[model samples]
Target: MFVKVVVVFLVMVGAALAFPHAPVQQPYYEQQPLMPYEFGFGVQDKYSGQNFGQRERSDGRAVVGSYSVDLPDGRRQTVNYKADKYQGFVADVSYTGQAHHPYH
Candidate 1:
């Protein structure tokens, strides 16, 4: 029993070592830049106390942008998006106005 266990352990270790692990590389969006079309905006309110902004770009290969706004109740909302030749568009949204739900 002891010998069999030792053999199995050694085999597992050998197999793991034989298959060398490779480091993961950055995603295409992170490495490549979207150019040829780029624009951005910013706005602020000193009297009413509100702000909003957006930035967008595309190069026929990829599109990326970010938008943010201030809510009337003093909450902020932001959304980010990215689209590339390889992987389509991906968006991430965050805001304080979102409804809360209890987890089951």
Candidate 2:
């Protein structure tokens, strides 16, 4: 019983030292850009209405992405963009207010 207690104590100490005291929060958006390859998609944040999903072409000649962010005035803004060798770049933005709904 004494030996078991000592072993448990040692294990606990080892774990405490091996793991981080505060968990590291690396959002998916930040991680995607750091990868070796540039083609991927992820949602970086949700609560604040911030997220991005993007991808690059295999030939490296084009990229397409979309992102959304919440405004301070209780409105949400979204943007969609595309870039290619033929066309430099094009983007479209739309704003939606929480208080206004045309369909409803």
Candidate 3:
């Protein structure tokens, strides 16, 4: 009970310190991660939106694979799907302006 309370307090404190300059703008959209094996595919964050999902079961001792998000504008962002989230192999994400249609 005491540990839980302390943990919660610390989390709140950390969040406050971390996002001290967070945009006051309210998020216009929200998305949840996909379940294992179930994939959610769509033009991720295209035109004006956010796209986020997880390739099911691409973790653990399993031979990791690669994944990509091709926006509506001919831009393919590939990322290695590795064991564990965040701590796994990942290329620092980069941004690119749409040059062509992703529908291609």
Candidate 4:
């Protein structure tokens, strides 16, 4: 009986020493910097009859942009847009000139 008790105590001690308590960990987060930028681009191909352009600017809080494309009917379709945290996305569309259809 004494030998059995001694063997059990030794086994418990060995287990306690093998597995130590783990320390609690806290979560970490990273912060990013905000930057302002603006850009514009345009493309015009006379052979392919493709004409389009776009311009945009952003100041971290709000964004504004405009784009225009030539329609197959000869009218130019233009769109002006703006977006922010409060009003969300808003756009205005307009057309210039008149459409022409050629007979086959």
Candidate 5:
């Protein structure tokens, strides 16, 4: 019994020394810089009846934008939106003009 216990102890010690513990490593992350910008674009084709416009600006902390499109029903749909770290995202939708339907 004594010899068996000694042999088990020696085997455990040998295994521990044979495979040493590896040093732990922490994860690494790269940070990117943010820049402020503003841009607006629009398109209008009277012959094809396609009209749309969008304007947006970002100040690094918050973003605000509005887009308007001429819907097929003759009404124009406008959507105004804003987003930020504090407020999250919010949008207001509105429409203008009346819809007309032609019967065959």
Candidate 6:
């Protein structure tokens, strides 16, 4: 019985060692220079790659929202937003490349 237990323990230890695990890398947010066509799953910005914007998808085939980005020429492009990453309510966005006035 003792030998069997030791053998089992050793087997488990060997298996664990053989299959070393790695800590998962969390998705990181990155910044990009102002440009065109940037997109992503959880963040938003100009320069289409990993900076489009973040969204949650919750329902059937689609998610919807909006975004905006500053053009290098100073004009801002306002865009609609939608994400298939999860499907749910996201946020609204608008762009104009001008400073926002906070009070009515």
Instruction: Report lDDT (CA) for all predictions.
Output: 0.85, 0.68, 0.56, 0.90, 0.89, 0.54
Which digits, one per residue and each the tens of the lDDT, describe model 1 over residues 1-103?
9999999999999999999899899998778664579899999989967699999988768788999998765667899999886888899999876444424
Write one digit per residue (lDDT tens) for candidate 3, span 1-104: 99999999999999989886756874453234434453445445566666644343532333344456646565656665555444766444543556675556
Best of the two (4, 5) by TM-score: 5
Model 5 Cα lDDT, one tens digit per residue, 1-104: 99999999999999999997998665442144446889999999989888999999999778999999999888999999999868999999999999877341
Candidate 3, residue 30: the lDDT equals 26
Better of 1 and 3 by TM-score: 1
Residue range with the least summed lDDT across 10 consecutive positions in model 6: 29-38
Model 5 Cα RMSD, 1 decimal:
6.4
Name model 5 segments beyond 4 Å from true.
Answer: 1-30, 102-104
Which number leads on TM-score?
5
Which whole-number lDDT from 0 to 100 does residue 72 have in model 4? 83
| Off by more than 4 A, model 1 | 1-35, 84-88, 96-104
At residue 79, what lDDT does model 2 achieve? 81
Off by over 4 Å in 2: 1-59, 99-104
Would you give me the overall lDDT of model 1? 0.85
Q: In model 5, which residue pairs have backbone atoms overlapping below 3 Å?
A: none
Order of all candidates by lDDT, from best down to worst?
A: 4, 5, 1, 2, 3, 6
lDDT for predicted candidate 4 compared with the true structure: 0.90
Candidate 2 lDDT, 44-68, residue by residue in tens: 6657555545544433445666666
| RMSD values, in order shown | 13.8, 14.8, 17.3, 7.9, 6.4, 15.4
TM-score of 6: 0.26
Q: What TM-score, computed on C-alpha atoms, does each candidate reach?
A: 0.50, 0.41, 0.26, 0.66, 0.66, 0.26
